[model samples]
Target: MDMRLLVGRNVKRIRTARGLTQEELAERSGFSQQYLSDLERGRRNPTIVSLWELAQALGATPVDLITPDDHAD
Candidate 1:
């Protein structure tokens, strides 16, 4: 699987698990809702610092964002 797509999936998974909407995540992450939406759709490439920031917003570690789901091929 593509790394970008993997990260996107992880982001969406965590966000939903935390009961946060894209807009809510955007507010917490200091990123625009559009950006989060694009990211969830696997349309943007994020930097490591960005991953860190996003992870903090989601109350997760950077490794969580990069880790692949077991059910993912």
Candidate 2:
């Protein structure tokens, strides 16, 4: 699987698990809602700084955003 897609999926999973809306996460991360949408859709490549900020906003570590999910066979 592509890393970008993996990261996007992780971000979306964590965000939803935390009960945060895209708009809310964007506000907390100081990013635009459109940009957050793009990130979640795997349409944007986030910089390290952006990832850090997003992780902080999501109450997660940066690695959590990029780590691959464990798949069940």
Give the candidate number with the greatest lDDT.
1
What would the TM-score be for candidate 2 when compared with the true structure? 0.90
TM-score of each: 0.93, 0.90
lDDT of 1 by residue, 1-67 (tens): 7878889999999999999999999999999999999998889899999999999999999999999
lDDT of 2: 0.87
**Model 1 steric clash pairs:** none
Model 2, residue 19: what's the lDDT? 100
Candidate 2 lDDT, 1-73, residue by residue in tens: 6766777888899999999999999899999999888888888888889899999999999999988787311
lDDT of each: 0.94, 0.87
Model 1 lDDT on a 0 to 1 scale: 0.94
Cα-based lDDT at residue 61, candidate 1: 100
lDDT of model 2 at residue 70? Answer: 77
Off by over 4 Å in 2: 71-73
